[model samples]
Target: MAVLPLRICGDPVLHSPATEVSDFDDDLASLVQDMYETMAAAPGVGLAGPQVGVAKRLFVYDWTDDADVRHRGAAINPTLWIAPVPAGDADPETESEGCLSFPGERFPLRRSPRAILQAVDAAGESFEVRADGWLARIFQHEYDHLDGLLYVDRLTDGHARTAAKVERKRGWGVPGLTWLPGVDHLED
Candidate 1:
């Protein structure tokens, strides 16, 4: 497995909806493996296919919950269901999240505390997960990537304005920009 180059926010692939995986073949397996490697290299809990320019409906996650239970797997052609997010402003300290595409930046955004993820493995076997807390947040974040939406797109108030300004200042939201995990030094 290799650490794939991650597409930055400006990349069209990151902004476009990903296609569903129809062939559960060796290529898909390799992509999933590489995604995991890239995610680890990015030091992120989750990474999506579009983040790597694959434009496939898949994401790999490796996050250990507070209970010390390790949750690790690839969700290919996944369907996610989230409980209604709580009403009111987000708690900046607890609700903030970052994306591999956005890189190094974290913003406060509201997300459902619980989520149900149903997807197949590389081998085409189906599985389901009922997740809560940070795990739920991870699922939601990655799922958004499949639908061509970034966490920043879901931000509100000052956070939303700040994200737009950052994108403009950095000259992102275009196409063909990417960063190699562990190779480039990025400051938040």
Candidate 2:
């Protein structure tokens, strides 16, 4: 599978809601492979279809939990439901997150610490996963893309404005934002 160039923040494709994956055909399979490869190359734990310029409801993830167990899969036409916050940690913003679409930046955004995910596997078989902690966070982050929302949008008003400012300062808030190969990491 080839590693596709990522569509950065401000790309229209990223802002628009993706269409459902009605045809579980070979092309869809190939797109998923490309997404996985691209995400791996970017060294990101998760990636959505819109991030790679494909506005279809699909995402690939390779996440390792705190236990160090690795989980890898692709979700097509996925649906995710956030679980209620536990006592005392109602604010999830304390745990920051970063996105491949908004490479090199991160901001704390409130998110559910648990989630229920329902989606078809890469081969079109239906499945369900009960997730918590960082795994849950990844699902929510990717799910937002399917609905035309970014993690930055989930940020508090002040943080959102700051993120937008950074986007503009870096010449990112424009049409046709393309990937800049090696500079695509929050740690950078």
Q: CA lDDT, every prediction? A: 0.92, 0.84
Each model's number of backbone clashes?
Answer: 0, 0
Name the top lDDT candidate.
1
Q: Model 2 reaches what TM-score against the true structure?
A: 0.90
What would you estimate as the lDDT of candidate 1?
0.92
Top model number, TM-score: 1
Worst 10 residues of 2 by lDDT: 85-94
lDDT of 2 by residue, 65-170 (tens): 7788998899988999887755432243557888888888888776788999899987889989899888998999999998888888777677789898888788
Total colliding residue pairs, candidate 2: 0
| Candidate 1 lDDT by residue in tens digits, 1-188 | 99999988878887889999999889999999999999999899999999999989999999997789999999999999999999999898999999988877899989999999999999999999999999999999999999999999999889999999989888788898889999998766
List ranges where model 2 is wrong by over 4 Å.
85-94, 180-188
